[model samples]
Target: MDARQRLIETTRELLHERGYVGTSPRAVQERAGVGQGSMYHHFAGKADLARTALERTAALERERAEALLGDASVPPADRVVAYLRRERDALRGCPVGRHTQDPDVLADDGLRSPVEQTFAWLRQRIAGLLAQAQQEGSLRAEADPAAVAAAVAAVVQGGYVLARAAASPEPAAAAADGAVAMLEALRTPPRAPHRA
Candidate 1:
């Protein structure tokens, strides 16, 4: 791959493994196998490169989500579960969540806007799906779909953090699966009393 592509991929790998706080420009350069000059030529600095890399990561994630989301022939609950169970290259954390935890990134408007936008976008998309579920009568109507969407986002993100800290996938998967199961349980027959 070209130097720019290499640099972005290296940045993404480091960010996922080390987080924005732990990743260093030197580490990124070394990982990309590019000289300092080549790296600089492609990006203004670590922050710039990180922004680009993060945007790419968010785009990829959204695309993955959209694929499952658009396939309406599939059952709604199945789609929700499949979206959560989708195989991830690194199951440790959400790229958007990673950016949110970075104090430096949060402090810089230029650096953080995309990160904020990423979550806002994902949350909105989740809300839309929840609305669809509600309209389809697969999800209960009492619970605010936005609130439930936020909760779902929390499970996925919190699961990632727990997975990384615990150094295992079990915790994350359980939490993620449990959240979806809880939502699945919300489904009820029209005559059945709905549960939130």
Candidate 2:
């Protein structure tokens, strides 16, 4: 890859692994195999490079989510389950979700914008799927789509945290499975006929 591309990709990985404070410009340059002059030639500084990388990460995240959740051919309820069960590296944690814990990234709008928008989009998409499930009678009419969606998001994010804290992927898997089970419970079962 080119210097600019290498810098961006390296920054994204570092940001995901080390958070803002942990990822130094020197580290980025060394990892990217680029000299200070090369990095400076491509971008203004760390903030500029980080902004570009974060935006790229968010876009990729949205595209992957939309592929599963936005698929019209799949049943809305199935789509929700598919997304929750999607394979991911739990120990590694979420690239975007991890940003919320970074004080530096949280303090800067330029750095935080992509992270904020990515989560907002994810929650909104889940809410839409739940709403569709309700409309189709797949989900219980009494369940609020927005609240359920928030819970679902929480389960996934919290799963990452659990996994990282335990230093094992099992907790994350269990969390996901539990979330799926809750969603299964939300399904409206056929009612038995009343005995007159």
Candidate 3:
């Protein structure tokens, strides 16, 4: 690979392993086998390289989520469950989530927009599903779909935090499983007609 590609690839790996705060350009250079002059020639500095790396991470995440949610022909609830259970070995938060938690990372608009947009798009996708469920008479009218969608998003995101803080992926996985189960159970069903 070329020096710029090597640098971006190394940056992605380091960012995922240690997050933005812990990753350094020198470390990336060492890992990528690229010299400082070469890396600088391609990227203005650490921030620029990191931002590009983050955008790549965001794009990857977007692709994954889109595959799960963008296929409108798929059943909504099934899509939700499938996304939650996607082949993740641990609840290491989404790459986008890890980036947003970084102070320096979030402070940059160029870097932060993709992260913000990912969640925003996910929430809307969930909301649309909930709306579809409601229109189909499979979800209760009493609950607001948008609010429920937001809660769903919150649980998944917060689950990552809880699991990471506990140093165990179980809590996060459990939270996701539990939320999905709850939503599934709460699905509306036809009531038996009352006999006179």
Best by TM-score: 2
Q: Residues 94-163, candidate 3: write the lDDT tens digits.
A: 6778776788778888778778888888888888887887787877777687887788888778888888
List model 2 lDDT by residue over 1-196, tens digit each: 9999999999999998888878889999999999999999988888999999999999998898899999899999789899899998999989788888999999999999999999888888999989999899889999888888889889989999999999999998999899999999999996788999
Q: Give the local distance difference test score of model 3.
A: 0.81
Which residue segments of model 1 deviate by more than 4 Å?
Answer: 88-91, 190-196
What candidate 2 gets wrong by more than 4 Å, as runs, is 191-196
Clashing residue pairs, candidate 3? Answer: none
CA error at residue 123 for candidate 2, angstroms: 0.7
Task: List model 1 lDDT by residue over 1-196, tens digit each.
Answer: 9999999999988887777777798898888889999999989988899888888887887887879866889876567677777765335567667777878778888778877776787678777877887888778888677887788778888887888888887778888789878787777555766799
Worst 10 residues of 2 by lDDT: 16-25
Error of 3 at 14 (Å): 1.4
Q: Pick the candidate with the highest lDDT.
A: 2
RMSD of candidate 3 to true structure, Å: 2.9
* TM-scores for the candidates: 0.83, 0.92, 0.86
